[model samples]
Target: MKKGLRGLYYSRNEMDEMVAPLKFALVGKFSSGTPSIARIRARFAFWSSKDFSPSAESLVVPVWVSLLNLPVAFFHRKSIHNIACLLGSPLKIDEPTTDYTRPSFARVCVEVNHLDPLVNDIWLGDDDGDITQKVMYKNLPLYCPTCSHYGHVERNCLLKAPKNKNTPDVDSTSQEDLRIILDKKKSKLVEQPS
Candidate 1:
């Protein structure tokens, strides 16, 4: 892990064995003035200090977002930062974007609440015309809102209540029965006045 964070000037301390499953806390000091380590890529997951809490408020993660079809005029550092602000707290811009080598998209690292519905696109323009800039998030973590936790979606949530045995499971319902139900709803809607 230390080798992975080569230039960041970080110190590692192994947690007590009682904590179990082997965990190490790495504290890094960045000379760049930003406290974010979002650029670090590793096989393991990196959690912030607040992620240990069970509260939904702690459901925040650093994500890499790509602003697609952005205007070349907005490629400047300040302009990119401003555009990234619409998504979340902008951490840092990717090196390629800083150098303007990759014109396809401007990649930025941002810290956003996982619970919030991510923005798909944003309108950007002045008086001349407006263009829809598509937003794409990379490797966004799966989160179970039901359990207010990360790693799994709501459908596979372990905390979800088990279905009643007496209640029929939708998956087990016959195709004919589903068709009849749909027909009934359509008939009822037809009977109603517009």
Candidate 2:
């Protein structure tokens, strides 16, 4: 992975170090003309310079959000930045968007707080008339609202408390109990006629 990253963003004075498992902190001179790092995706991994620590209670991730059907007048840098602010802190705008090569949509990298409900669409224009612009996200991470964290959905949130007392907490379930349950299921399956 390190070699692949070096090949992609080559810099003579670049320094890369592993910060955590499957995570790396890269310090290097990258071309400003290059596409936004948020847009770069390799398999299940994405790149970001955001200060997202492992122990952070709140979840934040850099996401490439596309504002579809945006008016041509709003294609400029300032306008795109303002629109991106409605979603999150604007990180960087794609080259195509700044160059006006892709008029269909304006892509901007934004630092999105996962705890907040994402804006699906937004109204653009004055009081006389308005248009609904669809907001599309690239590689948005799974977020757990209950825990206010990323990497898991609400249903699978580890911090969520059980409604009934009899309902065993998944984490509290003993290894012996799990083994016994598995054995019982296996026996039941074996006893059934094939």
Candidate 3:
């Protein structure tokens, strides 16, 4: 009983929101695509992801890039050289910067954005039929400091906070986000940079 692509996508998106920071898994047509060492060495960056990990526990989801598998790129040595020349240099990615200017499987870097949820969804779908109900999680909102917003936290808060940004919001409803908002675990979760 393979869950359709859309169904799988929704389910995985739900799960990823739970485990922020690490353990992002990809499930799709090429979920097991060859590891492009070149891209790995290029040092790609991942932008902010809304739901990209597992919940209540540390996760290890694969950051897989959807590839076209260009035979010419690998078969023709000249093609590789020529493309490299046009590429200019390997792109450097950061929190806000992703390797998109001229991304290459040869570059060793791939971008993981929460915006593209279908691919990860498909990948997860192929793994198991009954996985849907087991991994679903709710969307986590960012917290605000000025008006006490719901989606952003203090460190990156767009507002001014009288207290440290990491301070738990007393208003978080039933502990289901991340720690204070609505964490699925309904328990205190330790925050660490992943």
Query: Candidate 3's residue-wise lDDT over 6-64, tens digit each?
Result: 23222444334333322442322323567698877544443235675433211222232
RMSD of 1: 17.4
> What's the distance in Å from true for residue 81, model 2?
1.0
Ranking by lDDT: 2, 1, 3
Each candidate structure's TM-score, on Cα atoms with residue i matched to residue i, is 0.55, 0.57, 0.17
What TM-score does model 2 achieve against the real structure? Answer: 0.57
**Cα misplacement distance, residue 34 of candidate 1 (Å):** 15
* Residue pairs in candidate 1 whose N, alpha carbon or C atoms collide under 3 angstroms: none
Deviation (Å) of 108 in candidate 3: 4.7
RMSD of each predicted structure: 17.4, 16.0, 20.5
Candidates in descending TM-score order: 2, 1, 3
Those runs of model 3 whose alpha carbons end farther than 4 Å from true positions after fitting are: 1-67, 84-88, 91-194
Report the C-alpha displacement of residue 107, candidate 2, in angstroms: 0.5
Return the lDDT, model 3, position 27.
26
Q: CA lDDT, every prediction?
A: 0.67, 0.68, 0.33
lDDT of 2 by residue, 1-194 (tens): 12211111212222111112113323334356665666565312534338656665556678999888776666757667777888887888998777666779889999888767787776655423456677899989888778777788889976684567644555878988878877888899999999
